[model samples]
Target: MDTNGMDRRQFIKVSAAATAAATAGVEGILAARQAPAFAQGTALGMLRWNDFVPASDELLKKTIIPEAEKALGAKITLETVNANDIQPRVTAAVQSKSGPDMIMTLNNWPQLYEESVVDVSDVAEELAKKQGGIYEQSRAVAQSGKKWLAVPWAIVGLTIAYRKSLFEEVGYSKFPETWEQYRDAGKKLKAKGFPIGQTLGHTFGDAPAFSYPYLWSWGGKEVEKDGKKVVLSSKETLESVKFMVAFWKEAHDEGGLAWDDSNNNRAFLSGTICATLNGASIYIESLRKPDQYKTAKGAQMRTDIAHAALPKGPAGQFAFHVPFSHMVMGYSKNQKAAKELLRYLGSKEVFDKWFVSQKGFAVGPTRDWEKHALWKEDAVMLPFKDAARLGRAPGYAGPAGKKAAEVLTKYIITDMYAKAVQGMSAEDAVKWAHGEIQKIYG
Candidate 1:
């Protein structure tokens, strides 16, 4: 919390410059000069998710790849794909015992494919030491058993993005901080014809991200901390489902039942829903759109829509964050070159540049980077300042593993809530999901 040795004023200035750079389309701004070309002997192939943030991919192509090439004297062939597609590709690579030298993807894929991913303990430990140690969520995500299967990259923070003026119209000056308040607000807003939404469909982002946080907030967990037992059929879980049922009935439209990942973003931008839980992308994307949404008159859409922390439940407010990780494939012919490239990219100096380029859409795993300037100075980014520490990875109260990832990816939790809200008994829904989860854990 102490700025981690960053001078506050200096960081504020840096934040301003970063913002200016984003709007001005600054090219290679982080660089002071060019360097000698890479000696063409070693080649490393990498596969990673095509960044949702366009600037991130741009920086990778324009600056990061070039710099790493110059420093390591290696030719790095980078191929990026959609986040959803990374898993199948990684699985194919693992099955065939050959693929790109390194891969980066979302949420415990390293753990899912741990046997096929090289041990990156050296990279993990060394980077943690360099970056003031890894955050708890990072460690839980990237490590499997006793080995570090991957290096934790950045975490995408998930929180509630809502319309402030609408809340004010409902007599609340700020976003609700507790579930009781949220329900009340939802009812009032729905009465005013403004729906409150949490996706019940099979969305890559909205379904699990929001549901898991709500589950944890109500003290419901898929598995116990030991990670081998099913504990989802408890009172806590039923309570979470029942709460969701009530809220959905009072607030959301039937369309939310089938909504996918981009639906909420489109809904919010079009003023269809007044609130939803999502990453900073919802707000970041609004910055590029026209100021035509009438949610807040005379104010820009970016200014009217605000980010808020997850509302507290009976347990407390717990944020849900997905850990994106980087790993070297076990079958790669160029393991050494792969590790070297990760080391270069993971350094504070280089990562800081990339973080700035990302426009603060994500938080790195390091505790020290918590003091990064964008968090303190950017109004839209400030809500996520504590995400690295306060957040819990998916499958909380248990280690992230294949079972956990399976439960999450299959939309079990989302379906549980949806069934209950759509008039199925909460107990029956829990029983159905509990059985599905047990099959995975067994």
Candidate 2:
């Protein structure tokens, strides 16, 4: 919803003269205006990241398959194939035409898989028709040259979480507005001898979420203009890296580098960090536990935390947002049936069961559904809903975006960010990183 605080420097430097994001946005809008409804059919086959387990099998038995049967007189049988990697899962499925009819994709996956997946623009058109005004950022995700490749299912938005009791104890008057203010708040707390604890580890999916906000907020663009290049090495990128290193030193404990995905949870719960980087799911978990927040396990004993928009930098504030992009593949035996399944999943009835009843497996990237009874009092998910309003997908979009981030992870971001938090200058680590990305993307 809010594309605020995006880094525009590296993108400017690397400009082919046209920005990929801007163009992508334009194309998607245009498609939404013109795409026709695809015809519906019968029982469709599906392939998902989770072939037989949590991401897929569990989803089908509990939500999708039953919903589809009810909506389209269709039954979906799933095929399990381990994606060579996330990017390949969609592309190879489209290119080879050997898998199931539908796919469960990451929000940005459609960009790369568009060439092979079915034209999903109509699904989104239906969403807009249903909601009056669809969340615009979601349009960015579904856009390709002339069609939408994915349907938004779930959103993972980020927010700042800090201990309210700690802030009160530190004599803080109010929450910080921009990232700088937030940083200063952390500094003040540290000055008072309370360490703001956080983690920077080689943990699952942490580095990108922790730092992407800064890069984006610093105004860094993932690709150069002219829609033809990547900007992982631009000045905006350099500055973003610089900011993280500074933030890490100032806010994180000395052992922050040793922290893992569960570290922030453990630390904030233990009152180790004054404020921590976390998601709505944390609060949701807390609410479910109830006593954890009230007892030695409660939000106070656990961390009487509150959520804030990620802090703003000199350029702009930022945070990582992950959205689930769902789609039916081109090879689905039941093409129309697959589309019907998609439609049913996005409807009011199924959404309740999938998102709330099943606990966010079918997520909403936009807050249009915020009024749903489930999220209103969801102590944790409500903030996530707020964060979703400001969320943005990965910089590397579609095939190129997904593929490049992979390169960034294998070559730069993963171990590089891990090491940078350990005292390496981010620039130095990224020097090796940018070089690594060049080799892979080029």
Candidate 3:
């Protein structure tokens, strides 16, 4: 995958460090790896994200479930849960060694529960070979310590969604293509009474999506390349902090300090802001509900809104592409049925149907799957066509494991930027973040 544009200042440094640290751990683990063969069972169970797009869940129930059951000669039951509840539910299930046979989760969670999850390297390899090749960033998140603990499912592409009319009103025919220009344009928009919005609160999705890309654009990283040392105290990071503080004052509202994942979506749709960084969900919502917008009905959203890959920085353009994954638990008695169900769903035919049902919001994991017609048909989605390749896991300068997950879950990086923007000194904020990160890595 071509994640060449995903890093600003320290791509080489972060990649090298994380690779060395992760490779050693993987080698030792794989040397002792042992896995059971596929033995079909009578039934299967999967825990999945409750569909934000209702049609998606409805279609899955009507199509994939019946097809998989028929193909595997087993009844597969799926339990849909909210995104926030997934970690606690999965953790409890893993602890009890009695729960669903498989589960869907965001980010590199399989790394955190590797010991309790069955190795699905076979399933992953089969899909990879069949699909030409899986994305490099996807592999990084799914593999850990030499085990394919989870199968790479899809990339939830993140990009900039903005009001085209608003930008053009300020002499910008298109969204700015660089950080400096983006900030300047934002300032202009702010003066025009429509500030750009970015959440600074502890939102799991939008918070990291915006903050990490900004940090990377400034050449700042959470940790050193070895994935052990905290590096947020560097000059590059301070520059990012200063930029964020000024940008927040001029471009964002105070309410953003407490906004959650849905806040920006609502804000953008309500005509409260000129732009925001988000997944296709925000843009999709605009199209799905043109009545909510200030523009007249019909082609209002399609004509007024557009997307851009995150603007380039002095280091280069960067963005966060979070990989969603699916895994089977080792303790499940129905592991064979679960694997069969995964295989059935992994087929291009099954996934393509689900992808369209969601209006192409779900990204295909590999390059070959790009043959789906969605990218060609929608201009808003075209920027995300290579998202699986041009994005990074949140744990950029570190291994995607328990420690990195902890830092992210606790909102360490988000809090750091939030504090700085809220008037905390840049040095003090970095110090606080460094201290917090040290507790995790150490």
Candidate 4:
């Protein structure tokens, strides 16, 4: 899913240090002695996804933006669209050279647009030094070599949100810990009319979040460590695809093939599906409207929901979290204002408001957030606390760069599984995906 405080004396000391650091040449510093001067009607355009947790978006629009505008002395317009549609908007902006001055990007997209973005090394490094360092997973997608193509934002950790009662009713007292066990449990659940929910569509978030980790857990990868050699057509990949074909037939909601990232969330909330691999948004939504979402037995669905990490496979458990970052577009005329806005929004005080609104659907890019007291508020959210530590970026065993971004944007891995589930032979699906990836890598 796309999911803080300080003492007064300590805050003052930190603010003073930040002011000093701002004078030391950092381009974007929120704690500057005074907001930088700009044209009387300076304005910046920001494009972001319609966040899964609606409250987070609401927080941005109602609270954060006004505060930012007053603090930075610029008019800010926030535009949001579905996550799947973000890439096309980014592509359009890069091509037209005039669009939102700041664009929020997911996964390795910053890498795909590396040459079209301004280096925010000072902004990123400053954030890292102040907060605990950015997690390596977040850093991988935002940093190219030593340059910061984008400033790290947040990581939306995807987990298997399941019904505790449903798993127990299927004779599994605990959530299944391995793929075979999960499949076995899912088979029984489907027989009882509560199948698992998942998507294999060309979604930007949940589709890759599931597909990449599933591939890696079975020892399949799109490329080798050198990041050039295509090696996806392996015995392991074919085996995983073949297994998925049967698993889907036996255990999943068949309607998932056309579902987007939001579909599984809806399915789970409406009590139609027993479990889904998703961000904490599903559970968070239920919390937001406790009386609206209910279990089949007429109980609050929030009480029934619990989350587990993705089941382990032969190689090991893995995760492909959706890491988000803000890119200062190279074509932007409001570069100074946009960078200042990034600095403003990314500050701990401001980000905490948005983070609390998410209620654990999205975690901060830095390690400091894991230590936040909010994780202790809900046991169901604990699994996501350390999720970034276990995360593997796209193009596993290789750099998550432009080629990996191309493969991801193309939905190569996701289609590999979808094709098999739709009746293509597993070998053929694997071969098709391998060929597609080779076209990118070559």
Candidate 5:
């Protein structure tokens, strides 16, 4: 499918057009229209992750929902849980055929539950056409063939947030640009009691965000481009695993094996770690309470924080920025109300408030948001503005479809490294993961 080349080219074209539109001062919210009316007492339920950006959740509860209800004439119920717990909830709901009418999903989950979810091509296509087209990474995960499986939501851009002063003290004036250099810097930092923090646990976010990109950068992938053959047991895969085992021992926080998405955020904020691959949440949280999260010198920690893309490997620099979407469950009787809610949420008039609340933690699904004025507010956030441009989905070198989603939900890639770090041989770990993937792809 040449997904990489196609997405890159399309993104460049869309981005340039969007930027030019912004330059011409064409930025504005979608024009107001008549609110869609529904039956009295029609209530729709939604499930989503407890946003890493608490302000967004607060805004949702305190403002957006009330406004949405007034506009849509449908009572809404919102439920949130840990990101790691969402998949289980989704599985249970789909099996029982009665649960939240709509669920917020991460990565390529739309592909994973394609048959169980209602097609929202009408909602998705309208939003994309109005919002300068959805980013390819977002589209790749939400769209399957000619149908849009879900409405593409915002993308959480992942970057390595580090303590700038700590790296400088270790004689690294700038963040390391290559994996080897990063490992060297991490080794020195760890000796100084500041290790790089990363998780290889069964997390839905940070674990695979690190694992998939790290694997791809070293030229390891789960399947071939045709998406039929398993190819994880390669020399490249083994070499990456071996390096990770040593890296974990010499440079990373050893306790990270038990950590989830929020652990590294807390570890970095607590000043126990120097760097970690995370969303802008860590930085945003520090900014929210400058006095609460201060350095030893009593300086605001946000001042000392900077973000960089993951280090480059032999293959190149890559990222797996988490793509989010809204899926309307097919089993729900409230499909009409759920689709209305999707349209309301996807509208810029509403989403802008949530986006601003994120403060660059989550960028829009479309290219136009890259032109948003928020990027100019903080230099540290600039890197994330274009992060999705380098994004590669799971099942890379193949379609990020059902099989890839299976591998992701099973944590195969993340566990491959976890196994190697926890005493398994690199070759054995790769072989084990390869066999697991073979079962799914076959």
Candidate 6:
């Protein structure tokens, strides 16, 4: 908790400019000098969710685009489109080869643009070499067969949010540290008519946050590297799944099984449930936006609620982050310009605005930003920060990974996994889900 390492934003300015300059000096400026000939203005057709971090044009000009253009020597213009409907536009644009110069979003976009998208592998490697390894969990996401697609969009930020005053009302000066203690606290909350809002609906929100940490704490894993073979089905994973299902009925609302990711956020915001699960940033932003939080019974909060990392599971405490990064197109007319842009974006100086998002600072999945000036010495970050240390991203990165999640959600969402969780017999639920994947995937 020290204002130690470079305030990530400051580091970005100095690092990005310096790195861009070095590229010009070391690689020569042919691309820099040539980009303007083909591209006349800074016009980029971009698509993304509504509230993306670094989504502002001000940040784009100061933090991202300036450094990138300085190095690439071409002007870029950005066009924004709503994510809910942008897929079709992006598809048409890219297929027609008239898409924006750059596009940003989750790495798991349906149809990847290896040709249109810039490959930022070099940028990612540069960051890793400069920083003491850019967190393996995230690095894994950037790399594709030795080619890198992304650099982290700042730091991984999946963290828990909780009601602070609620903890105090429960007669505890502090919250419990271990899983057992957490369950006991839940019992206490139930005694007070504030039981946790449980779920089985959506994987991106409560389902994933609630499950992956369970696996990490128990030392469970979704896959194992067996020499050249990637093994998906494993005992550790089975145990983790079974354990997660056990909480489906206990922790969720009566309609929890039919809920989706947004359900938890709505549940918590509405105060229908004392605590649910969600991302650290979303939780913070929710507190700031009254519109984002509504009552379970449809009332809105007159005051802000609080959030922290969910309590540790039986295995151990852990966090779940969406490890995101940027990648470049292999077939770009401006490969050199694209790569330079990639380097500039990854440079700490260029991406600093991401840390100052209305939500909270995003550091390495585990690095503590609580002590930083940006956080202003806020202690509420402690638990969330602690959760980051051992957290895991749900396997949503690769094609196989996405398919796997779909498979799980399809079967598990309907209380299928609940049977196993409730001790209705693990072999059936476990084997059904696992065997189904093996057949389809194999």
**All candidates' lDDT scores?**
0.79, 0.58, 0.77, 0.89, 0.88, 0.51
Error of 3 at 302 (Å): 2.9
- After best superposition, candidate 6 residue 306: deviation in angstroms? 5.2
Encode model 6's per-residue lDDT on 1-442: one tens digit a residue: 2274558765565455445456553133323322322243433333334444434445664655654555555665555554444446656767777655455544234224444565566666666665556655565444555666555554445554555556567764566666556565666676666667666554444565565565556565434432112233456556656655544444435566677655666667656566666555445545467675754444444243455565665555676555544444333466655555655555544444555553353564213333345555455554444344554544432232444434433534234355565566655765665566555445
Best by lDDT: 4
The best candidate in terms of TM-score: 4
Q: Which stretches of candidate 6 lie over 4 Å from their true place?
A: 1-43, 52-98, 107-118, 168-173, 203-206, 227-246, 286-307, 358-361, 364-372, 383-388, 393-425
For candidate 3, the per-residue lDDT at 121 reads 87
- Expressed as tens digits, the lDDT of each residue in 309-396 for candidate 3 is 8887767777777778899998899775576567657777677788887665668788886777777788777777776667776667
Give the per-residue lDDT of model 4 (tens digit) for 185-217. Answer: 999999999999999998888889999999999
Worst 10 residues of 4 by lDDT: 25-34
Of 3 and 4, which scores higher on lDDT?
4
Cα error, candidate 1, residue 176 (Å): 0.7
Residue-pair clash count for candidate 3: 3
lDDT of 2 by residue, 106-148 (tens): 4455665655777877777777666544554465656664577
In angstroms, how far off is 269's CA in candidate 1?
1.2
Q: TM-score-based ranking, best first?
A: 4, 5, 1, 3, 2, 6
Q: How many residue pairs clash per model?
A: 0, 28, 3, 3, 0, 33
Colliding pairs, model 3: 17-225, 26-145, 26-146
Clashes of 5: 0
lDDT of 5 by residue, 196-250 (tens): 9999998888999999999999999988999898899998899999999999999
TM-score, model 2 to reference? 0.72
lDDT of 5 at 329: 97
